[model samples]
Target: MRHLALISGADANHTLDALFVNAPLRDYGLRPRTNDYTLPVLGMAYIATYAQRAGFNVGVLDAEALGLGIEETAQIVNGMAPRWAAMNLLAPTYEMSARIADKLNPQIALMVGGHHAKAMPDRILADPRMRHLKALVLGEGELRVAALLEDMQRRRELPGVLWRDPLIGSRAGGVADPQTSGQMLGPDIDTLPYVNRAFLPQDPYRAAPTPADRRLAASRGSDWLTAGAAHGHLEANIVGSRGCPYNCTFCGAAFSANPDVKIRVRSPRNIIGELDSLHDQYGVTAFRFVDDLFLGAKRVIDDQMAAFTQHRIGERYVWDATGRINVLDRCTDQELGTLVANGLREVALGIESGSDRILTAMDKRIDAEMTERVARRLVAHGIGVKGYFILGFPGESQEDLDATVRHIRNLWAIADQHPGDIRASVFEFRPYPGTPVWQTLIKNGYNPDELLAYGDVDLTQDGADESMRQRDEFNFSVGIQFGGVPLDVVRGTLALLTREQHERNHSGQEAAA
Candidate 1:
């Protein structure tokens, strides 16, 4: 039997040309070059695993890692000519997927899976360009695709897949029930196969100053801008766990469902072992734990630390992670210090908004008070804390926005009370497709039509946002509010902040003199 190949595309950068250099889209400084590449295709990875387990020949195409454009990717696939080619689609990248699907040879079966298919399956099935595609796997696609592939091999009927029928207009088949909805059946982190890095493309995509240059380097429909700091020593993004316990309004809709478990962590030994191997083999020394909340549990943190110490690997690496404010508040200073001493160079706490009202409305589960306490505690430990805040919410008013700004100021004041321990970063809220607020906005008639209209565009632009050039520095970044504040005013505010900081440093220099 011929092997089947599953090609998954992660969300790419949105086009910022219209927002920045072009006149059409609004120029919001809040936009960041960050795209969704680091997120492991946990779903697709499992599908590959399951299909392999089921005795079908299987392969995975991770386009970002491979640095292949749609045409290049299609050529690679066409050469291999797997009987089936599947691509995962996020709500934002449906159009991209559709275009990529068009590139495949007619002989290859085109399939898609992800949140957009679940929420609005009909919309995807109805696209005339994509209508002739082989299938759209519903729910968690690993099992669905695995079973569908098995059936296909045997020429068995498939019920969970969507297909066009002349009489019914469009119909779906081979669906397992609620129990199997969107579930990926796979092994614990240790049981999984090592990622076949050999399949990754030889040339990695590099971001450029111009869109045309990036396109020439990569290919059409590829626009993810990679970001890094000076040393060329960027951290290796890692995941100790897949699922998060919290269901924030801004988190993807798929996350809101009862998570498979509170958490499913790789053993501390497994984690440290991987980190060590990454260093020794891949020359990767720095790491960023991109879990929804790393150090989610105090006990887990302690356990992992013990493993690291036992392995004598702590000093070999530096790391950063995100955790809740409450977790830090509950930690003793010693525990915080220990992590820092071991390797934690910096930590970010998502204190989304300062107002208790906004926090509750957004289901953040913590308030301004807890946020302050956490910042202060991290400061006391001499650990750097990056404070994360968001500006807009579903019902947020002008007063709410002002309160959030002041709260951030107060948070900054706490850092000032203990310099170098804490810093502030703010993001304007964006109603992304898979999140609660996206649905909430629709529920409240907030007119997110344009956002949804651009939902399938990649978030990563080939070039950095033009606003990045407007100021020497900026605090309000990533997911900025779509409206309410003028872009010029936001730019001016950032400029003022930059000037004031420069002045303060000058005065401090004089005092030292």
Candidate 2:
């Protein structure tokens, strides 16, 4: 029997409906299917690898990618009969995680984690459905969990385990803080192991287990992983760093939300070594950095670029990363040219808003002009640009909305002129727990549960609507009237942008989910 099993279940969010609590949600298998396919659960991979290396038997089940329902997932865990089973929950996936916890074999100690879990630890432990959870991991799990398991097996004093004895009167939740936690931004990330791809289904994200499932993605235009399946383009997601340095208030990765997460960057040597390993072992040629701050700032990005150049990594491979508009705007043409020559195929930017006022409010140091300038410059350099925008933020004004609409159109125009691609991914602003906006709402008399009660919203109701056929896939809002902007206006703007993106994809350009 394995010592542990980590699972990523379907996004069966049941947090909506009831005013103050979650109601029994739909059957997991009955959840509406999407054309989208997910990447590997890297957190689970890291935790599994760390625990396994520490001499504990560990395994993983990515029910999210494998498209397994709660029942099937639990059955597999029960069959594996591991001593413990754990899951990482996002706001969207919290309900499914809880249901799976309930259905697990009583003997298997359950652990719940991820940012969502950290934001709701007491509630999770108190919830009847989650009574099976033995612990709730707070922040980064690889180091904390491994040591916790070792101490538990040896019956030693728990180094990071803050709470125990669920039956006790106090029922305090466990917190995994050690010397490293105190550093907050000082951990040597190179020490962490390369995430073992074997833990996940690889070729095409191991997403399509059967032929019919493959048909599903094809009907919606092949998923992003399918691009990797092209000759010599088999891709993998890599993270050169952990944690964001920026203060985008609406984002959960904002520093304020991650007080315990130490910001760590992998040395270029360490990163290249993993690239070589993936290339040799899994035949992966293309890479996408999933880090929140891959090209965060100038000095950091320069070091990363210098490493890629020294190794001539671009000669054979192409890669993409997240970037900041302010930093990239300040970049010299020569510096950016060097990046382009090094197979820097694309850069995903956090162009959060178009209005200068709104951008400041979001803590996105860059303004509308900077975003446009950077987008144009990148496109001219033959690098694809993916701009992410959030609308309907709390207290957002009509001028902000109009400015965003105009800004998206400007970027779309720039995209049309260059060989490089530019895609705008617009999302309605929903209150994510632990974000600055969430705290602000609470300060203004919003209930914590009310802020957490947004469920999966389906915005694509009309099948005949040719604009943005993929809008429903990316829509994560509950239509909460947090802002004065009318819901119709927000959606109307969404439709406009979605239709533009739809047309772009229809014309053979890549689309984002």
Candidate 3:
């Protein structure tokens, strides 16, 4: 059997869009187009690996990375002439996926998976508009994919498949009975082959410019930017673990669509083996670990570090990862220093809010004090820190906004001492479907239809806040804001923060001269 894996690109209607692959912020549609970075979907890559191992001809297509529109992507898939096609689906690209399915030959068995399908398989399967859809694989899809393909070959009932029941008639406008064979989660990830990156585009994918990079270039002029542009570096993305242990209300990964949410990690030896292959074959020296929470248990961290040291991983590559502040806060200075020594150049912290009260509401578990302690520790250890903050929640108030501003200022001050070491961005909260926050909003009289309709455009518009109607008129490359606080006040606060950072950078430069 021949199978194809597909990723949809931005539709013509969307101004700017980027898929993060991970659950929350699965799709980021930002304005001004600061940078172009498309990461390979490791899950899809893993699925392709399993398929090939099962003796099926497999091909991978990342429409976003290739910059191909729906028609172009369809042409490529049609040319491949595969019997089966599976797509990674997100809510923002739901309409685009449906359109692409319509364009493809109806005879081709079409299957969908990912955050959206996993969260609402019934809604996706029942929609008559998606009649061309055949099946959906829920949760972790590697084993399910292999099983589904084998079942298709033998004309057996599909296992781990979501489909419309043949028994159910057009009772409610042809909404068929949603039935699932079963849910499947893969065994040891180490047992799987390394992601087949060779199937991906050959060109080096440029990561989106960070806030620190933007501010540094603005302060230092084009000479610095020119110098930075000349560096020849290749970055690859890998996942060390699957699923998150902590539950944050706004996070789709933690609370949405994932029913059998088990956290599985690849052995350090397994991870190092992949790195060795990349370095030997592709000369890739930079990596981004896309695990939801990379720094989980102390023993896991110890084993990974030991493997890195034993295998000389630090000598070959520099890497960054996503982490929780509480985990970082618990590490000793020596532990962090060891990580820095082993090529841990940067770590991104989801310090979602500065207000402790708001943090509690979001079930972040950690308070503002924990955030400050962790930021200071990471900065002191000479590790680059990237901060992600959110502006609006269901009950966020002016006091919460003020606390967030103060926290940002504090983080900026720490960065001031070490210019170019800290990057921060504050995004307006968008209530993604399948999350606790979204469900709560629905229970509180928020219209679900309007929210889903907003989709990718929701980033640029505020569905819950009427005051934010005119906020999108301004062009602030830094971040988005959605709250009762006046737009001017928010912009003024941002400007003051930027001005302070600029002055600090100037001072540091003069001293260096």
For each candidate in turn, the TM-score is 0.68, 0.85, 0.77
In the predicted model 2, the residue pairs found to clash are 184-262
Candidate 3 regions with alpha-carbon error over 4 angstroms: 1-35, 153-159, 166-183, 202-232, 255-257, 455-513
Off by over 4 Å in 1: 1-82, 138-169, 175-187, 198-234, 253-262, 416-425, 446-451, 455-513
Let me know the TM-score candidate 3 reaches against the reference structure: 0.77
TM-score of 1: 0.68
Residue range 206-234, candidate 1, lDDT tens digits: 21122112212232222211112212333
Give lDDT per model, in order.
0.54, 0.68, 0.62
Ten-residue segment with the worst summed lDDT in candidate 3? Answer: 15-24
Query: Between 2 and 3, whose lDDT is larger?
Result: 2
lDDT of 3 by residue, 180-204 (tens): 4323444567788877675455323
Total clashes in model 3, counting residue pairs 3 or more apart in sequence or in different chains:
0
